[model samples]
Target: MTETPLAPPSARRSRSRGRSQSPRSNEPGQNLHLRVPYITRNIPTYDLLSEEALDRIEATAERILAEIGIEVRDDPEAVRLYREAGASVSDVSANAWRVKFEPGMVREILKTAPAEFTQCARNSANNVVIGGKASVFAPSYGSPFIMDIDGTRRYGTIADFENLVKLGQSSPWLHHSGGTICEPTDVPVNKRHLDMVYAHMRYSDRGFLGSITAPERAADSIEMCRILFGSGFVDNNCVIMGNFNTTSPLVLDGVTTQGIRTYAEAGQASIHLPFLLGGAVSPLTMAGSVAQCLAESMSSCALTQLVRPGAPTVLAGFLSSMSLRTGSPTFGTPEPALGSLVMGQLARRLQLPLRCAGNFSTSKMPDGQAMQQSMMSMMSAIQGGANYILHSAGFLDGLLSMSYEKFVMDTDMCGALHAYMKGMEVDEDALGFDALAQFGPGEHLFSTDHTLRHYETAYWDSALNDDQPWETWSEQGGIDAAQRANTRWKKILAEYEAPHMDEGIDEALKDYIARKKASMPDAWY
Candidate 1:
């Protein structure tokens, strides 16, 4: 068998160009670094529940949908669509309707959604495929406050948002440029989405998410994509995605349902997620919460198909376990991680791409607690076979804050995951029979030819970890991982160069933003 590198073939062909000292330690910027467009899992998904158990959970979801029903608030169009699609609809109030589906109605309606599709990036090489055995890593989303390098927590500005986008673009491990890396509190509430979308367009060429706070903002995001990518291309292909959340305990609010329809009608992709907090918005029991999540997400995703058949949609689950005594939210716990695993199984059963758990933590700082918690949550996403993994880095304070130091630290972990998910290949080179023949019982293989040929690319090298002896560590100020991550992020930002864009396209995009912003006066609320 031929000897091959562990990374995807696409990764081996790429190289770091004009990069400063890499944030990763040990490896220089000029080294033979591997970069995958997205993770194609070679290993099998870990199925924790039996088929019978999964069937039971799915049945429970159907029961919830048929009996209890989901209320559509302030969206008559959504209510009418549900009614046309064979669901029972009744008036809950003048502005709300109770829409209930038969046991199999939702499953049939979801048949039009594609299982997998490509989200194109400005640079074609960075295009990522969602669904099947592929997985994409992206940064944390929707953080209003940031934990600064000096440990001060404050509101995020547009500068901070741009910097985060730059950091994501610079990392070889992250596939998609995430949405709402943090809220630009300094910008007006009505107009900040334009700036956020522009930052993703100018600073990064990777596929990214769009705004979903309102339907018009969602339309604005799609319009900007048309300027960057041609109109025909935008209409026919998926260039951008919107991440929308459902109000939990069986409710699809107007803003979210309308947002889903907006992206679907435009032929773009959307992730329908139910952010369920156990004991609060959902059932206290894990199984009950999982069933509720499936019901809520499935109904919301079906709306996308209703708007336009064969539109791309991703099923997402954000399950959190809350403290029973104080009713506070918890993250990176084992229960929710288990919930994520189960959700993966359910998504596969439905033949849809899944977005699951991430590097979640409640720790205020980038300490041992943070890493430990992140590993527990992130591993579930990896082992469970999720397609798009959001919050892949920099999540802290129960997701109330995005830590700058934690962001780089989490990227380093993502680098390791790139290797971990590659699994292993067994071949002629891997057998190493020639080395065994040359070495005696008491001899070592250190100087063998096989060792020399493969040593450089043998293992995943970490950049932030210090493995030196105590004396060397002490001489170097005994810096910890967080301190090292702090230095690295600053270094990365200082050297970051925005990917080049065409002059004409840039001007058109700026003109669009200017006209849009000028139309609306600054509304800070």
Candidate 2:
């Protein structure tokens, strides 16, 4: 993949509000080397459907939208926006407004969406170019529980949340700091966004996901970001992307639409995700489920365009299924795998960036089940041509829990996947036919310059996966992968140094959080 051109010099103006400029890690001349490598498209994508099949799915989705229609919940302004956009909206029931799209309206609104754009990082070096050939990976998100090496599983707190952000900052393979790494249950629901954004600002220089639990919370996120990146910069660039998940079986709730409105109006990025549980929330068949996903994702994305044309939006596919016997949600299944592949094709056709799940699992332990599930979801996402990958690590218990050990384990695997995606080089230097000719038959080239030159990066290495003899393993006490990962994570947190920031800016951010928390009433529900 080719590199995108840099933004113009005018886009790099310093913090210019009424106050003086503040110190930042990426303030103009400073350089930081913590930038990780984002995946680029280098191999062929997996095509599971024929052209005829894909066309059928698209037609089915349009038919679903134009006929049965989808509901927009408790948001008259959203209904009005759709009404004004030529959609037929009906409020025939309490808290429900059914919207029927005119034929081709979905595709028409999608025309204004960008095929590629940049999500700016505090440090310019860490900026991510989403869409096009870029494939960026973020850490696990929205898990409510935390797990440790002693088999401890419990509610997560603010301390646990900050530590996870630090871990993401330290990982060389993680691209984004993630959203809701683990919910800080100790904090009040209404005010947690302030603390969460503060943690991200203090511990991570990478770009981050925005709050979507409430529309007001989303506005607070933008306000805090304005303090960090300066008002002018935040307004003109996509610094934080919000994740807006629509309710399945054709419902768009008020909180979600408001969040979308807040971000879309500010020129920020938003991922229009629909969490589908096939055979339950949607159709059992992959094609039918994909068609539902298209209607849900495209319809919500079109709302963003209506709010503000040219707003950066992503088409997300988080379609999974449930076990027929127990009705328990399952991850890494074939249905979701096919859904991811088809999602990629559809996103490309609509000229928008795509987001897909990663390392998702139902396992409670970081064992074979966890690894298998993670590999299954991640492999399909990468090969399916996803532009942005969320939940790239630590997702467990069907995304209800986050495992520290599993996070480290998944990072190792993700790095390997990235290496594999960056297909082999075949230049004269890479071919090295001359070096092979020198070695001749049956002779060792271990002492040659070629071996020494490529030894550092010629092969992928595992941080925790063991491949030693029994005697060697015994000498190391035969500790399991989880134990090794636990030790590694502790070391990472201990050695992690937060990127530098201006003292004045840090104090101002603290003041803002304190005032914001005091302003809002404590809310639990």
Give the candidate number with the greatest TM-score.
Answer: 1
Count of steric clashes across candidates, in order = 2, 0
Cα-based TM-score, every candidate: 0.95, 0.93
State the local distance difference test value for candidate 1. 0.88
How far out, in Å, is residue 208 in model 2?
0.4
On residues 154-233, what C-alpha lDDT tens digit does candidate 2 reach at each position? 99999999999888877767788888899999999998888998898788877799799999889988888888778877
> How good is model 2 by TM-score?
0.93
Which one is best on lDDT?
1
Q: Per-residue lDDT for 1-525 in model 1, tens only?
A: 011113222122222333332223324642244567788898889999999999999999999999999999989999889999999998989999999999999999999888888887776667789999899999999999989668589999999999999999888888889999999999999999999999998888788999999999999999999888878768777889999999988999999989999999999999989999999999979999999999999999999999999899999999999988888998999999999999999999999999989999999899999999999999999999999999998999999999999998999899889888888889999888877677857789999888887777778878788999999999999999999999998989987877767667889999999999999899998
Quote the lDDT for 47 in model 2: 78
Locate the minimum summed-lDDT window of 10 residues in model 1. 1-10
Relative to the true structure, how large is the alpha-carbon lDDT of every model? 0.88, 0.83
